[model samples]
Target: MAIYRKLEKEDKEKLVGIFQQPSAMYDYREFDEDALIADENCNCIVIENDGEIAGFASFITYRVPTKGLVGRIEDVIVDEKYRGQGLGRGVMEKIIEIAKEKKVSLIDLTSNPKRAAARKLYESLGFEIHDTGVFRLKIK
Candidate 1:
């Protein structure tokens, strides 16, 4: 059985293992379990298969002057071994549910063009791409 639920402290080791998978697009950042759990604005969902972590997704809600409350989904992934089993969809659906519960006015996420499958999933979940440029400044 697969269980989808909020991330718990005990899941850190397994979650870190998932993040260690190589991704040309994303670099692994230090996992701040305490910060994630302490911050009310951050919502993280984890999928557990049998006794191991199988997938994870998260979103952060913030107040925007023009849009009211909005969310940005981030770090969605399923274990490589668990791919093609609908775990990604299940985790994403759980994130959407959290967004609805928080009354978020809008939810946004960015996916690399190379991630065709991920982009397709987002589109199927009603996320439409807006014609806008994304700029980032690496401060670190």
Candidate 2:
């Protein structure tokens, strides 16, 4: 059986290994050791399958000033070999529990349009597709 737990300070090397992929869901190029180990607002959870890190989810909680308190799912990644399993759902469910504890009124995330399965997972978990436009400027 797999175990879902919070990232520990000792898990840095393993976590970095998971984040090092070029096509990772989150940009961890500047992933800092201190933040991963001590940041109160950062919650990084990992799933261990037979003592190996198989997947991870990072969440951030913050109040958008006038907009109110909200939680944002920074990233969710499951190993390619574990894709068909319900690890992603487990990650989200755990995050939802944390969000509720933090009194977050809303939780949001942005997913690639090409990730159809991921979209379905989010939608089934009660996340709605809002009719809003998002613009980004990439730096080279």
Candidate 3:
């Protein structure tokens, strides 16, 4: 079984182990736990199985003039070895809890269309695909 907890800076080693391609998981060589904790509106949590990181998810809540408070779930992942065990659900549930606690009016996320399983999970959580355009310039 996987146990869920808030992420900490010290969990870097265990977290890195969960990603097959570390580059895809994170852009930096080191996990910046300090930055995450210091951020006022972001919450991150991790799932541990037998003292190892099984999965993780993060969300950021922001206030917009027109939309009120909103949250976006990001970096959701479960180790390939731990996928079938409902670890992803555990992580997402935690994110939803945080969103509710923060009084966020809406929460959203984006997943690759190829990730059918991911889309299903989000749907099960009551997320609907908003027919909106998502554009990025990719400045980097």
Regions more than 4 Å wrong, model 3: 22-31, 133-140
Q: Write the per-residue lDDT of candidate 2 for residues 88-114, one digit (tens) a residue.
A: 898988888888888877788888887
- Most accurate candidate by lDDT: 1
Best by TM-score: 1
> For candidate 1, lDDT tens digit of each residue in 1-140?
78888878888887777877775233446678888989889988888898788978888989879878888888898888898889888887887777888888878788788878888888777777877622111111
Give Cα-based local distance difference scores for all models. 0.78, 0.76, 0.74
> Who is ahead in TM-score, 1 or 2?
1
TM-score of each: 0.88, 0.83, 0.84
Residue-level error in angstroms, candidate 3, position 41: 1.1
Q: What is the C-alpha RMSD, rounded to one decimal, of candidate 2?
A: 5.9
Candidate 3 per-residue lDDT over residues 20-53, each given as its tens digit = 4542354436458898878878787888988887
Quality of model 2 by C-alpha lDDT: 0.76
Tell me the lDDT of candidate 1.
Answer: 0.78
Give candidate 3's root-mean-square deviation (CA, Å): 5.7
